[model samples]
Target: MDPDVAMWLGSTLLTIGALAVGVTVHLIGLGRVAPTFALGLPGRRLRTDAATFALTHRAATPLTWLAAAIAAVAAVGALAAGLGTGIGEWAVLAVLSAIVLVIGLTLATWRAHTALGDDALLDDSTNGPLRPGAD
Candidate 1:
C-alpha cells in the first residue's frame, strides 16, 4: 500500500516489457538475416559467421526470459504498492530502474564477448592459428 512500491513495480514491468519486445524483434530480424550470418568467412577463416550469430541467439533467448520474469515481479510489487500508500516512491522507482537496466545491458554485452571469445579465429596471411575452436 505504498506509492513507492507501486512505482518501482511499474518501472520494472515497463523495463521488462521493453526488453522482451526488443528481443523478439531482434530474433525475427536474425531469422531474416540468417543467410548473411551463415556465410563462411573468406580464406584463412575458420568458422562460419553463423557461429557468433547462433551463440548470440541462444544467449539472448534465455536472458530475455529471465529479464521478463524480473520485470513481471517488479510490476506486481509496484501495483500492490500503488494500491497502498503513496510516499517517496519516485526515488525507489528510479533506483530500481537504473539497477535493472545496468544489469541487463551488462549481461548482454558479456554474452557477446563470451561468445566472441569462444569463436576460434585464424590468420590466413600468416597461415597461423589465432584462436582454435571452429572453422
Candidate 2:
C-alpha cells in the first residue's frame, strides 16, 4: 500500500475514534445511556450507581471534549507526517486522553467534596469539653 494511502487510513481511524468518544460523551452527558451500558450490566445501575455519579459525569463532559480536540490534532499530525498506523501517533493521543481523564476526575472529586461535604456536626461532647449540655 502507498504511504499516502496508509496515512489516510490512519487518519480515518483516528477520526472514527475521536467521533466515537465525542458521541459517547454527548449521549452520556445528555442523560442518554451509552451503548456499552446495555451489554455490560442490568438495571442501568452502572450508569447511576454512585451518589457522585452525576458529578463525575459532569466532569467527564469537558475531558471528553478536550480528548476529541487533542485526538483530532494528533490525527492531523499523524496524517501529515506519515506517522499514521504507528504506535507513536496512537500513544500521543492516548496519553493526552489519559491526562484529561485524570485531571477531570481529580477536579470532579475536589468539586464534589467541596460542594457536598458532610456538613454534619457530630455530638463530640464526649471527646471535647462540655458545652453546658450537662451530659
Candidate 3:
C-alpha cells in the first residue's frame, strides 16, 4: 500500500480500537459502580450480579483511566497522520471523528465519576473493600 494510505489506515484503526476500548471500559465501570442507578426497579437480580461483578473487579476504575489515555493518544496520532497524509479531506475528517470520540468518552467518564463521588470503591489499601461482608 502507499505510505499515505498505510498511515491513514493504521491511524484510523488505532483510533477506532481506542474508542471501542474506552467505551467498553466506561460501560464496565458504570455497571460495576452504579449498576442499579439506571436499571430501574425491574432488574433486582441483574443489579445484584452487577454489584458482585463490580466488587470482584476492583481494577475497573484504573482500567477506565488507562483506556481514556490510550484513546487520547490515538486521537492525537490520527490527527497528526491526517495532516501529514495526502489522502485529502477524508483523512482530516477521520481525525476529527477520532477527536470527537475521545472528547465524548472523556466527558462521559468524568461525569460518571463525578456523579459517583468517587473514581473507585476501593479501600484505603487498594487491596479490596474495607468493610467486612464487602467484595
Candidate 4:
C-alpha cells in the first residue's frame, strides 16, 4: 500500500476507535446509574439519597457531554484526514486525547456510582424518596 494511503487509513481507524470507546463508556456509565431513577414500586426501588443521586447525575451528565463532543471532533478530524486535506498529526493527537479523556471520565463515574450505592445502604434515614414506608 502507498505510504500516504496507509497513514490516512491508520489515523482514521484510530480516531474512529477513540470515538467508539468514548461512546461505549458513556453509555455504560449512564446505565450503571439508571436504577437509581427507576419508577418501580417503592419497596422495589433501589435505595439512594436524593442529593447524592442528583450530584452524581450532574457530574456524569457533563462528562458524557464532553465525551460526545470529543468524539464528534475526532470523527470530523478522521473524515478530513481521509479526504487528504487534514493534518495526520492532529488526527492522531485528537484520538489520543479523546481516549485519555474517556478513560478518566469512566473512572470518575465509577467512583460516583460506588459512592452513591454505599451511601444509600449506610445511611438509613436518608434513603430519599425511593423507600416511602421505611421506618
Candidate 5:
C-alpha cells in the first residue's frame, strides 16, 4: 500500500467517522445539535436548558468547522501523496494528523461544552420551539 493511499484511507475513515457522528447526532435531536454533538459522542445526556445548548453550539461550531477542514485537507494530502508509497509512512502521517485533529477538535468541543449556560445567547441558537420534540 502506498503512503498516499494510506493517507487518503486514514483521512477518509476519520472524516466518515466524524461526519457519521454528526449526522447521527443531528438526527437524534436536531434541536439539541450542540449538546448532542458535545456530549453524545462520548455518551452523555443533553441538557434541557436552551441557553446552555446555544452557547456551546456557538462556541464549538467554529472549531468543529476547522476540524472538518483539517480532516479534509489531511485526507486529500494523504491521497495525493500516497500514489506509490508504502503504508508505513502514510500510517505515521495518518496517526499524527489523527492525533492533532482529535486533540484540537476535542478541545473545541470541550470549550463549547464548558461555556454553555442557561442564559447565554448566540446567533445560531441550537435551541428553539422545534427542539423540545424531535424524531
Candidate 6:
C-alpha cells in the first residue's frame, strides 16, 4: 500500500477512536449512575441524588465539550498529517494528539472536582447542602 494512503487510513481510524472514547467519557461523567454501581460491584454508597450531582454535571458540561473539541482537533491534525510529506510529521502529530487527549481529560476532571467541591457547595448559603445529613 502507498505510505500516504496507509497514513490517511491510520489517521481516520484514530479520529474515529478518539471520538468514540470522548463521547463515552462525556456520557459517563454526565450520567447520574452511582460510581460504584457503574463499576459493576458493590461498594460504598454515595449521595447520587444530591445537589452536588447537579452542580457537578453543570460544571462538567463545558469540560466535556472542551474534550470533544480537543478530539475534533486531533482528528483534523491526524488528517492533515496523513496528507503531509513526511512520516516524521505523522509521528509528531500522533504524540501531540495523545498529549492533548490526556491533558484535556485531566483538566476537565479537575475543573469539575473544583466546581463541586465541599467548599463550593458549603459556600452556597441559600441552598445549603444537598443532603440534610451531608457535611
Backbone clashes per model, in order? Answer: 10, 0, 0, 0, 4, 0
lDDT of 2 by residue, 1-135 (tens): 765666677677766767566566555444455335532112242344332233334435565566566666666665655453565565555456445544544553354334333322123544422211122
Model 1, 1-135: lDDT tens per residue? 555555665566576665654465255224433424233111212124443454444444455456555655555555455556453454464456456644754665455445444533335666433422323
For 1-135, candidate 6 gives per-residue lDDT tens digits of 776776677677767766765565444444543343342111122225444544454455566567656766776776686576566677678667767766766776666566655465564666564442244
Candidate 2 C-alpha error for residue 132, in Å: 47
lDDT of 1: 0.47
Better of 2 and 6 by lDDT: 6
lDDT of each: 0.47, 0.48, 0.51, 0.49, 0.53, 0.56
What's the TM-score of each model vs. the native? 0.50, 0.50, 0.40, 0.40, 0.59, 0.60
- Largest lDDT belongs to which candidate? 6
Q: List the residue pairs that clash in candidate 2.
A: none
lDDT of 5 by residue, 1-135 (tens): 654544666768876765654444333333445454445433132354553454445446556656656765665565555554666656665666576568756876675556544343333456432332321
Q: Worst ten-residue run, lDDT, model 5? A: 126-135
Candidate 6, pairs of clashing residues: none
**In model 1, what are the clashing residue pairs, if there are any?**
1-84, 1-85, 2-85, 3-85, 4-89, 6-78, 9-74, 9-78, 46-135, 47-135
Ranked candidates, highest lDDT first: 6, 5, 3, 4, 2, 1
- For the record, the alpha-carbon RMSD of candidate 6 to the native fold, in angstroms, is 5.9
- Evaluation by TM-score, superior candidate among 3 and 5: 5
Model 4, range 12-66, lDDT digits (tens) per residue?
A: 6655665554555444334333433342112221234443443444335555556
The worst-scoring run of ten residues by lDDT in candidate 2 lies at 126-135
